[model samples]
Target: MSQQKSDYIDEVDVDESWDEHPSRDELEETVENLEDSGFEVEVVEDAEAALAFLQDEIPAESSVMNGHSTTLEEIGFMEYLNEGDHDWENLYGKVFSIDDDQARADARREAQTADYFLGSANAIARTGALVAADLSGSRVGAYPFAAKHLLVVAGVNKVVEDVETARERLHEFAYPFENERAQDAYGVESYPAKELVYRQEGTEGRTTVVLVEETLGY
Candidate 1:
């Protein structure tokens, strides 16, 4: 059985301040700064619009891979990639279908170089930086330069005033909730073992950040 955010969100305690939507001016400035940092920026009304944008943007026959992202699940992208009638090849499905642990690990590493890598950021600074961490490097390995292109889908709640606040949010807010989720889902503890502070994109069209208006993920 799959677990939704609604299933355990209430059981976790996080700073609500980290989840508040920023003002319109703040959001606009963030978008501008993100664009200045060489990232393609798109502000969507909600998760549905974000999903629609992805459906139109990714070309048919492209290889698609994704990290373990609650935001992606909230937006229905994981389900869609696994079950939807899309033309693209879902590399995640292929990688995980292997029965051998070592073979699956190798496949996961190879999948990082897919045509499109999708995931969510734990915190987005108003200065245009993105903050995220994972127990392993699996989730963030594609963000820097592994994949041909990176697509980040995050809610406005992840936005903070600056990089300092972004890191704070990662520790004080995102980590706790994620730890709880990890314990419940996998019966193990999780930590910020591999942290990433993404500041800029060198390639013009290599990265895109889709910011959704509604709060959807941690």
Candidate 2:
């Protein structure tokens, strides 16, 4: 039996080799520090606020950019985007393969124009840095860096204690999850779809995390 891309995308890598994970409370503290320094932090009680915030606060005119965000899909982001007549572009639209110059040019130009960007962390460290695993060059840096106002939609399940926990979640949670998810969602029938795995190309840009009350994702 073979694995599917969508299945993998929904599951998290399970690596035992990484150091022991930290407690949820500890991770929250680190995230607090990040908020104090520069990043903005907002914790929502449930999906209702998230949807309302996404539909209203997240500029109706801005071209909404998306990444590997099942959370967004679950929340009906496309409907909101379409209902508002906001333009959008992402890896889904020839987002998998684009040259570097084109990527940078698009990122620099398109990002500046967008009033808001709707994306989420592959993993959210309680420390506050949003982690993302992007195998495609388009999602590598363009999505996060380009958006004017970044909204990191997260499920309670994605939260971790620190960067190390974030990394472990990537290896243990991210790798295996993304591997199987490429199928039903995108017709990718391969598990651990090499193109969607996290390689840590570089650091993420300014981001605000939206932590849901319930668990979500692998």
Candidate with best TM-score:
1
RMSD of 2: 6.8
**Per-residue lDDT of candidate 1, residues 76-159 (tens digit):** 888889999899999999998999999999999999999999999999999989999999899899999999999999999898
For candidate 2, write residues 1-218 as lDDT tens digits. Answer: 22322444324445433323335675467557657545666666677777776666554334555555667766666455545444444323333345586775565445443546666666666655656665554343544355566676777667666677676676666655665565445666433222222212233435566676655454
Poorly placed runs, candidate 2 (over 4 Å) = 1-31, 83-113, 187-206
Candidate 2 TM-score to native: 0.66
In model 1, what are the clashing residue pairs, if there are any?
none
> How many clashes in candidate 2?
33
Every model's TM-score: 0.97, 0.66
Find the candidate with the highest lDDT and give its number: 1
